[model samples]
Target: MGNRLDRDQVVGTALELLNDVGLEGLTLRRIGKELDVQAPALYWHFKNKQDLLDAMATEMLRRMNALQEREQEAEGGSGTGTWQETLAGSHRTLRRVLLAYRDGAKVYSGTRFTDTSYAIPMERFLAPLVRDGFTPGEAARAFYTVYCFTIGYVIEEQSAADDPGRGVKGIDVAERAERLAEFPLAAAAGAELFGDADAGFEAGVAAIVAGIAATRERGRKVN
Candidate 1:
């Protein structure tokens, strides 16, 4: 018989297993085995795998949102130097964290939690946008767009964890170029556009924020 596994211990062990084997490889039985306990023991803490995943996601976001909130507080909730800088910082942090572990983005995007842990980051990240005259709804939408793009980009960027040479494999640069030659604009910019993840994220966030600012300015004129 093994000693009792506390809530934190359970979550920590589960997270360890998740990182080692990914979301698809994680299971209650495996976690219990790792802790030298029966599967039923885990059930006592988490109702099911979904419950465990929700808790894990909450835990991960809690740490991220905390740092963001502190930065927000330091910057006065609304007056950060550059909203786009803040967005880039937050999303870059998120991207790095998700890419550090296996299937991290999938786990994060798949779960739903009501805990304000998730919203605190958004509130902080959106502060600059709101201060810049974007309506609350616009800020929210813009935030969502940046977040979705970051997650999607990371997932696609790291999906080939099982392959070491994934990047070079099947990459027929010449063929791809020839195929896209019909579209002059895409062909010209395709390589440059997809080359840098960080650059793409910054550009995307900048464009979104610019659009929001424009919308706000337009609305102000109308009003």
Candidate 2:
């Protein structure tokens, strides 16, 4: 009898290949080859490339879900900190997880299955706004801003890793400093903006949370 491959085994292999070859290079044929099985065998578990990608995406979200659940539990089953604190912690945890593999955010964002990862956080994040007197629609919009900032930030950060020299190749800093001297503020802050993603991520999350609160207050006044 042939060795029956389980779903976990298959998805695990796919993840392994994803780390090794990235999304573009991942294919059923390649996964099968890695598994020492026929390509057709993979079809028994997944319908197509998208199906496989969705499974992988779900697996990643599963990890995030577990982490957040434990985090919430540690807070005595409620998000005791400020909403910014809760959300920033989640973002930091996510960045660490995604950074563990090659093309992690690409695998995450490129796949269509974000509901598993998003739904819980969405609920947790929006609840504060709703409790604070914002309408559901307003809260939803705020959540989108935070979501967009985090996702966009990670994608740009990871893409930089692929190109080496931190994506500023062949540019002599001394020469660039002379050119940027006309813009003193830019020269002073450019390094801060680019240095240390952990700090940047926290700062961006803080700004977004503040923006959300301010927008909610404005909406309350208009109402």
Candidate 3:
């Protein structure tokens, strides 16, 4: 049996099957069937579904890192950006990667990383922020703030995007406008909230960055 599969191979198979069976339906036994092996084989690599999930999230992080590396290479390395831009851009790539797979954002969120694959790139982005006056803790919080924003946004985005495929209802702006017409402000807000996803995401990033910057300035005054 091909039970001698490595961790990455196991994770790759799981992600491939993720699109078809989706997160809830994915299983080690199902993956073994696909690999033509006994379920024990997968256990050699993953002791539990959560273990497998952590590895899968790490693999996703690796993919995000690889894309950033390529972008740096294309720009002749040591790619330039302010700390805010750098942080925002990292999560933007994360959003793209998460959106690439069915329930990808769901798979990623709340899953722990199995390795230090995120360390290097995370360090790269955190450096400028730390040097610019934010403490390591503050910088980490900022990164996480944007990271959570990206994940939450993509989760909603995926839900909305998936509705049509499964004949489900989604964020129908026109319908919302009509239903909430009694409250003109609430009705009009739908156009901004769900109308232009790209713009909405950027606006969120900008607002978060601005908040971080404001906190940093306040800290400077206190010091």
Best by TM-score: 3
TM-score against truth, every candidate: 0.77, 0.79, 0.90
Using TM-score as the yardstick, the better of models 2 and 3 is 3
Error of 3 at 36 (Å): 2.1
lDDT of 2 at 180: 92
Query: How many residue pairs clash in each candidate at the backbone level?
Result: 0, 0, 0
After superposing candidate 3 on the true structure, give the runs of residues whose Cα lies further than 4 Å from its correct spot: 1-5, 164-169
Tens digit of lDDT per residue, candidate 3, span 105-209?
A: 999988999878889888988987887767899889999999899989888777755463321125778888899989999999988887777788888999999
**Ordered list by TM-score, greatest first:** 3, 2, 1
Worst 10 residues of 1 by lDDT: 164-173
Worst 10 residues of 2 by lDDT: 164-173
Task: Indicate which candidate wins on lDDT.
Answer: 3
C-alpha positional error of residue 160 in candidate 1 after TM-score superposition, expressed in Å: 1.8
- Candidate 2 per-residue lDDT, tens place, 127-152, comes to 77677666888767766667667767
Better of 1 and 3 by TM-score: 3
* Model 1 TM-score (2 dp): 0.77
What is the C-alpha local distance difference test score of candidate 1? 0.73
